[model samples]
Target chain A: MRTDLLRRVEDRLRSLLAAERDLWSGVHEGAVVPIDALAELIASGGKRIRPAFCVTGYLAAGGDPDDPGIVSAGAALEMLHLSALVHDDVLDDSGTRRGVPTVHTKYTQLHGSRGWQGESRRYGEGVALLVGDLALVYSGELMAEAPRSVVPEWNRLRSEVMIGQYMDVHAAAEFSVDPRTSRLIARIKSGRYTIHRPLVVGASAAGRGDLAPAFEEYGEAVGEAFQLRDDLLDAFGDSADTGKPTGLDFTQHKMTPLLGWAMQRDEHIQALITEPGHTPDEVRRRLLETGVPDDVERHIGGLVERGCKAIADAPVDEVWRTELADMARRVAYRTS
Target chain B: MRTDLLRRVEDRLRSLLAAERDLWSGVHEGAVVPIDALAELIASGGKRIRPAFCVTGYLAAGGDPDDPGIVSAGAALEMLHLSALVHDDVLDDSGTRRGVPTVHTKYTQLHGSRGWQGESRRYGEGVALLVGDLALVYSGELMAEAPRSVVPEWNRLRSEVMIGQYMDVHAAAEFSVDPRTSRLIARIKSGRYTIHRPLVVGASAAGRGDLAPAFEEYGEAVGEAFQLRDDLLDAFGDSADTGKPTGLDFTQHKMTPLLGWAMQRDEHIQALITEPGHTPDEVRRRLLETGVPDDVERHIGGLVERGCKAIADAPVDEVWRTELADMARRVAYRTS
Candidate 1:
């Protein structure tokens, strides 16, 4: 049932883009560029983790399998993620995403090669800005098809993500925010936004608002695990599998929780990050020597356990509980 | 009646920001920065044209003046405009808006003064990007409170504006996209988006979708007049009254319709614009000497008459038609 609905979610996205492409193509040949950018990113594979959780949440809450609103809610989550990623890439100055040149990078190069009138950097980033804005708008359009009851949760989810992102950017610049700020950002961004709110959005679509409390607990635990895994992946994972350049958090001086721990153990890590001529390799070795990686691994294990416990008595079927447990393990352990 | 509704619109905006300020203040000290930036812009002042058109359309369509949804819808239009302005300032690299420093400029200076970790330009623009994103989300939240039937027009209005912006940016970069393309953008951006759609959204909120055709005819005519008047104002108006620097269009080499007309008469004007060392005074002199400004003024007069005529026989009361006619004249002949 989940698979069928997920397939429809993909269909919904494709059809929406197709319709837009047709609508704009009649206006001007260049009118479809932003739409094309969005479609290409959607075509390029993403884990669709938000959609997966949303779907699983709906079904687990006894949502009818045939309801199309679930599909729309799921698709809206993915579209919003695309919007965030596109803008986030600009914020991070990331050149590549999902093994492809980023929207900004591609267009910036286009401007330069074409000898466009304005600064190529501005033109490129400007295009990315509008594209992201369009995706953000499209996400709202897709969610409009969902049940009206999903409105409150969806609204909270979006505003929370934007606020969390703002805080993240501000904290990275200050570079001296307390570790508690790092944890709070992690929970706001990863735990609540990526997991908890999506699950509740799905549950609400299925007429199951009662599932919110349990979903929040489960989401917060699993979300932190997911984020910890992300930090570890960025530090220790492979670029080939992840499809993005690793160690960006390091180069950008992002104050990840893992980095926070390493800095606490050894102050030199800060100079290595903030100053020039130091490689990511040097920072990696020093982090390992701090024994924080081992501690992080153990903490991730405890988090997964806690996440599973959250859903154990969530008024769901045994099958769903077991499935949720397995999903938590996958989220906590699997690499990008 | 309109005054009462407009007052409610202001209250809605202030109270909404106050609520958001309180909500995020509890989270972190710095979390309220973006929300505050938005509030400052709203409080600074704008023409509130879109909201005025929306309220007018609703009242003319016989929508209940007591309907809280109209206030929400009016607030949403203004919020969306604020989002566009914040982002537009970044794209244009403009220093001031409404007599205050643009959000990006203020934050960029903050980053520089504080000796923050990242590039000052990136930090400031990133802040603006997210601040604009928040406003976009907030607009959606506001619109959700209106009648559900406004969805389709609302969707089309948003996507069209984004695409229109993308085209505008692209046109500004390529420095040439044919006269027809410029007109299309002007119509898409000013006519359909600023006037027609807002009016239709108002009518839709009042359950009067059938009024869209007349609104479109009137909006397109008046919107074009508005854009032309804007061009002339940028070229000739005083900075003190507009609360921003004048002649930005000439400095930025924007392919406005007025510039298009001027270039057609004297090709030297193009060189004066695209190259440095030539002042806006020189460009303005050449533009006026070509006598295109006179023609544009005459064209604007024709447009206002046409706009009023489009709604002369609509089912609305005679008072509304007169009020709309007065609005058209005010928009076309405004000094600022």
Candidate 2:
């Protein structure tokens, strides 16, 4: 059933992207570059975790799995995710994503190869920015066709992610390692949008707005677990598995909860992070010796336990409750 | 009456921004930085031409001027403009806007003063990008509160502007100075959103969707005139008067209609634009010698005349016809 729903989401996304490409192609020959970039980015696959969560929420709330609205809304969630990823690549100066050149990198190469007249970097960044904005606009356009009750949640999801992104960037700049700030950023940036809002929006679309509070609690737990696991993966996961280099958070000196906890206990680690002279391997070794990743894994386990309990307590069907529990375990323990 | 409506729009904007600020303050102490930056940008003040056009459209379509929906929709348009401005500053590498430091510049200063860890410029640009995304989300949130009939137009307006921005950047990079592309970019990037869509949105909110075709024609003409005047001002208008440095278009070698005309007529002008060695003053002098600004002014006059004629021919109240004509004249002939 999950695979069927994921397949539906993939199909819906492809069709929507095709429509956008067709529209831009009608505008001008060159007008399709950004749209084509977006299509390619979307084609590079993700786990479709958000859409899966959304579909689970919809079905748990008694929505029919066959409803086209569910697929469309799920596709919208993916587009919004793509929008964030495109902008994020530019921010992180990441050369590739999902083992493919990022939108900005692709455009940079295009400019370089064509011997374009402007600074290739600037032109590339500009195109990426516009493409991100276009994807965001398309996300909203898709969600507009979804059930109206979900619109407010959709709007809140968008705003919260952006605000959380600001908080993340701000904290990084300030070199803030406060655990509270780290937790807040994690919850708002990843937790809510990744799990909570998708569940709430999905339930709302199913005409089960009343289920939002329970879903929020469940999602918060699962989402926090998801992020904590991500932090662990960033430190220790295989690049081949994650499709991204490990130790990015450490090298970037991003104040994840794991780092915040480690910093509180180790002055050497704090100096390494604050001074920015240490290599990722050195930091990762010291961090492992300090047992921070172990602590994060323990926290993820606890959160997964809590999430499973929340799902059990939620006013949803037994079958969906089981599925939700399975999803929580996968999210908390996935290698990627 | 126009002044009263404009005042109302301003007040609406202030209160909405205040609400956002208040919301972020509750989220986290540091979360308010981007929101505050946004408030400062909005307070810096634009001419509010888009809002005015929206109000005029509402009044022309027999909508109640006092309807709160009009004010909210106008605020949405303004927020969207702010979104574009923030992103534009990043794309243009502009240090200032409206005589104040741009968001990225201000944030960069903040990063510098605090001796933050990462590169100040990257941090600043990241914050600006997130802030722009937030503003775009807020724009959609506000428009969602507007009358439902205008939603499709609102979506189109957002997508068109972003698509147009891509075209502008692409043309600059590819050194494509085709007049047709320039005009299309002008219409899509500035004209439609600035005048046409606002008018259509206002009218649609008033249950006058049938009038969109006529309003679009009028808006296209006025908007083209407005952009052409902007190009001329970029060459000839005083920095003190325009609140921006002149000759930016020429220095950037952006494919404006004025540049398009000059390039077609003069090899020296084309070389100066395509090659980056010449100074802004040199380009401006050479462009003036070619009489391109005069030709642009003449084009603006023709467009303004056509716009006024469009308004006169439309099936709307005569009072609005007179007011719109006045607007067309003001937009076409303004020095700043």
Candidate 3:
């Protein structure tokens, strides 16, 4: 059932992007590249985890599992995720995403191939930025089609994610390594948007606004676990499994809970954080010696168990409660 | 009356930004910087011409002059313009705007002063990009408050400007200096959003959707003249008068109609276009020798005349017809 819902969301995204491409192709040929870039980025593989969570939340709140509206709303969440990814790549100077060349990288290559004037880097970044903005606008357009009752939640979700991103980026730039700050970033950045808001938005769309508080509690637990898993994957997961090169958090000296824990264990670890010219293997080896990943895994297990308990206690249908619990486990233990 | 309306728009912007700042300050102190950056950028001076045009358009279509909705919608246009300016400064690597330091520059300075760890330039640019995105979201939020009937036009206006920007950037990158491409870029980039869409959106909000065709003709003529005036200011106006350094168009090899005219007069100017390391004075001297500025002035005169004539012929109230004609003249002949 989850796979089928994911397929529907994919279909909805493709059709929406196709219509946008057609509309802009009539405007100017140059306008088509950005749209095409967005479409390509979306076509690259993702777990569609956010959309799945949204669908499950809707189902738990008594929304029709087969409703096209629910699927469309889920697609909007996915599009919003893509928008963030495109901009995040630009921020990270990432060369690829999801095992494919990122939007900026692709545009940079296009600039070089065409022997374009001005700095190719500038042109590429400009195109990528505009493409990201376009994706954001399209996301809003899709959400505008959802039930009006969900509009405030949609806006809140957008604002929270952006604010969380600012906090995350600012902390890294400032070299802030406190565990409290790290956890705060995780809660606002991933915990809320990834799980809490989606559940609330889904519930609101299902005319189950009353269920939001309960879902928020459940979402907070699951979302924290989700981010913890993500941090672990960034540290130790295989490129083949995660579709991302490992140890980026270490290289960037990202202020993750794992990093904070490692720093506490050995003050020498501070020098390694965002240390210039450190190889990923060396950083990973040093971090592993601190046992931070194991500590994070234990925390993830506790949070997943807490989330399952929340779902069990939620005032939801028994079937959906069971499904939600299953989902919490899957999210907690997923390899990718 | 126009000055009073401009003041009201400014007041509206201040209140809105203040509310946003307060809301985010509660989220995380770090998130407040972007909001503050946006507020500072907006507080710096602008002509507020877009809002004026919107108001004029609303009144011409018989909308209530005292309605807060018109002012709110007009504020949305200004916010959208702010978003574009913030992003444009990042793309151009501009140091200042309106005789004040640009947002990225201010943030860069902050990073330096605070002795932050990461590359200051990267931090500044990232903050600016996210701030621009925030402003864009705020623009949409304001528009969502406008009458639902105008939502489609709002979407079109946003999409057209973004597409126009892509075209402009693409031409600059590809070194495409054709007159046709330049005009097309101007029409979509500035002409539509600046005058055409505001006029249409204001009219639609006033329940005068029937007047769209006539407003489009008037708006197109005026908006072209407005952009031409801007190109002239970029090339020839004093920094004190224009609040920006002169000859940016020449320095950047911006594909303006004036550049097209110069290329027509002296094909050798093509080599000089986007020539690296040439001083702005040298490029200005070469372009002036081509007499393109004078030709552009003549073109601006014709467009202003045509716009005024369209306003005269439009099927709106006679009183507003005269007022709009006067506006076209002011837009065409402005020094700054």
For residues B215-320, what per-residue lDDT tens digits would candidate 2 score against the true structure? 9988999999999888888877888887666777865668888888888888788688667677877888888888878888788889988888888889898888
Instruction: Return the lDDT, model 3, position B177.
Output: 55
Order of the predicted models by TM-score, top scorer first: 1, 2, 3
Rank list by DockQ: 1, 2, 3
Candidate 2, after superposition: displacement of residue B303 in Å? 0.7
The estimated TM-scores of all candidates read: 0.99, 0.97, 0.95
Residue-level lDDT for B227 in candidate 1? 95
Which one wins by lDDT: 2 or 3?
A: 2
Is candidate 1 or 2 superior in DockQ? 1
**Residue-by-residue lDDT tens digits, candidate 1, A1-336:** 888988998998899999999999999998999999999999999988898899999999999989888899999999999999999999999988999999999999999999989899999999999999999999999999999989999999998899999999998998873789999999999998888999999999989999999999999999999999999999999988898999999888899999998898899999999999999999999999999989999999999999999998999889988988998999899878
lDDT of 3 at B99: 92
Task: Give the CAPRI rating of model 2.
Answer: medium
Those runs of model 1 whose alpha carbons end farther than 4 Å from true positions after fitting are none
RMSD of each: 0.9, 1.7, 2.1
Say which candidate scores most in DockQ: 1
Q: What would the per-residue lDDT of candidate 1 be over residues B141-171, giving only the tens digit for each residue?
A: 9999998878998999999999999999999
Provide the TM-score of chain B versus the true chain B for each model in turn. 0.99, 0.96, 0.95
